[model samples]
Target: MKLSPSVSIEQSETGLEFINVASAKCDAKIFLQGGQITEFIPKNNKPLIWVSKNETFQEGVSIRGGIPICWPWFGNHQNPNWPAHGFARTSLWQADEVHENDEQITISLKLPMKQVNTTYWPHQSALKVEFILTDTLQVRLTTTNLSNAAFSYTQALHTYFPTSDIKNTTVDGLQGAQYIEFGEGPFTQSEHVSFERETDMVYTQAAVQQHIHTPDGIINVSRENSSSCVLWNPWIEKSKRLSNFADDEYLGMVCLEAANVLEDKVTLEPKQSHTLITTISWA
Candidate 1:
């Protein structure tokens, strides 16, 4: 892979390789492991993505923050012993393309199926993630089915965002969407979402965009090819049980993931493809 002047391959102390970008528009870091992006900061603005300070950059271990690519499946699988999220977050990816110009930088990565354990994912498919960075950040996850048979799956770009205070942060633009929290009813959202306790809400038929009101400013989050999303914050007790996460870190971050889960799971026939896109910027 030929890297431009603004981008280079970097390795962590734990031997994980990632691509680092520093350009006129923004600075970013994307790990080859899991095809995950751990940082993105625009030229004149605060960071739009957040990662845990306690995160360990070990091979096969998913970093606790940033945008963890949940693919093949999201959350729990049918078998209790399977990994919580799919293997994509822990699998290594190949750098397929990298381009930089004055306006922005684009990096493309492909997940090699040979690295995937067939025991978990038997179907033949192609998965890739492309990051387009400028004063704003855009992530595109595309999957193409290669097998003759049709297959279905659920996924999410589990993006974590920063906040000066979770108490004052609120998410707007989900009005009238249906959500299921803690396996409860698919209740209708009557107002903007506020965090007071542990929140694990799966929403369907959501609007294409939402605004996150943080102490720093309002962040605009928009999605395409997705009608579902997730809002989560592990407050208090649950925060204590999380690994590679500080107990009090919940107060400073929140996750509003653009996803395809539950009723919005994707099914593709042979030769078909699908893409899930999410873009973030200060409003």
Candidate 2:
């Protein structure tokens, strides 16, 4: 995958390169000193998550959704052009702008109507994604509905956080909120609580932020305008199937995603917009 230097390269003040692979479409690798990936990797199969290492993260992370502008439908419901998660994550997006400060690097990408065919989404829309990597990581995705009618869609940051143990971890955020547990069967909202194994849940109307208590330190997730939160750790058996993820790697990570799904879909009128913001800080 040869990305033209003109198309997909940005740098920090210290000269650390952020490789943006537009063809991989949803892939990004952040390289720091000694070429470490201090983030996440996109598995070829899922384009989400990565193998977790015990040390500090080596890769930056993958952005799973665009401002993933899904229209008319979401999830898997027999749509040809628009797949289960939406096309924004898989479609080619142009690098629009880049900036660097003393402490962080920010890169912006744009997906427009001219950039993509609006067959599944028959409207002109502008999707902008900004990746701000400072001491903490802040990812913001904003979608503007440029079309005439109102549009509704679901979105997620789908973050893969590095940790030490799945069993010894607890996410502190949705303590009193409601969540849809996917552990046994269909979606059902229950009281938000701690985890043990294979905990796949969607907390409804959750707080804008959450905290993961790992042995090393706490990773706080702060967000805005996103009412749903997802907590998942895919145990062992399921981990082997992923190419980019190592088996038993589940022991070193937990996923706490910021989402707008099902009951909390966003609707925008012509030229109106909505923003999904997520900030990951270590303490």
Candidate 3:
């Protein structure tokens, strides 16, 4: 492990790397390999994120929890054999900037196109992720097109939140939105969402803010420039098949992702850019 005043490089027993942070209103741990945040705990509040105690933390492997960045594309690729969630989650990122102020601390990391595999994304683009560590953690991910032509893709800030119990927790503020899961009906959300079994719903034209009513309390998840969000919990059997995840871990974790999918996918012209932002706080 290597240490700085507010940040450090920590390696798991398996030799996976992580950038541990404590510069601002919260403590965080981000993996340098993926620039993926695996942990964040704001002062005076309970831990909002959760990871498996049995996580393997192997290098070049995606971490099991916190906020995973799904870029360029999400889910299964058109080629079928391609990676499930694009390359950003497995690529190494450079820490381009780090700043601290009385109000907050900010860390910026950029993934240069040269470091990415052309087979996954043949376009010239620059991807950057900025994290504002404060009492309420804020994150912004930006993508800039460097080529003359246009490129389009869907993405998500696939964030996982901790809960006392999945069945007892409900996600409100999605009422009236439209959701689809497993080729099911384009169901209209007429009430708050609660879990009974496995869920993998993707909601489009969603509201900017939502509330997670966990046994601990209500957590506010707010988004900007986002029209879609995903609600997922791979309850029971599926949990046993996940990597670096415990079989019963689904009981304590739920993903409320800020996303751009289907109609909300982004298309950027030459030199154009798009940013998706989200903020979280406990009430």
Question: lDDT tens string, model 2, 1-283?
Answer: 2334323566645444555533232344533221222343232322223334323222323232112333234345466544655666445456667665454556666665574555667777787777665455577878898888988877776677766667777777776666666534344444434556677787777888787887766778888888876677778777777435667777877777777876888888999988888877665
Q: Whose lDDT is greatest here?
A: 1
Per-candidate local distance difference test: 0.95, 0.60, 0.87
lDDT of 1 by residue, 151-221 (tens): 99999999999999999999999999999999898999999999999999999999999999999999999
Model 2 misses residue 273 by how many Å?
A: 0.9
In candidate 1, the residue pairs with backbone N, CA or C atoms under 3 Å apart (3 or more residues apart, or in different chains) clash, namely none
Give the CA lDDT, 0 to 100, for residue 191 in model 2.
40
Which RMSD values do the candidates have, in order? 0.7, 8.5, 1.9
Q: What is the lDDT of residue 267 in candidate 2?
A: 85
lDDT of 3 by residue, 1-283 (tens): 2244787777867777677787647888887777888888987678877777777777778778888899888888889888878888888888777777777878888986787778888998899999888888888999999999999999999989999899899999999989989979689999999999999999998999999999999999988888999999999989988988888889998999999997889999999999999898887
The residue ranges of model 3 lying beyond 4 angstroms of the native Cα positions read 1-4
The number of the candidate with the highest TM-score is: 1
- lDDT-sorted candidate list, best first: 1, 3, 2
Worst 10 residues of 1 by lDDT: 97-106
Tell me which of candidates 1 and 3 scores higher on TM-score: 1
TM-score of 3: 0.96
Regions of model 1 farther than 4 Å from truth: none
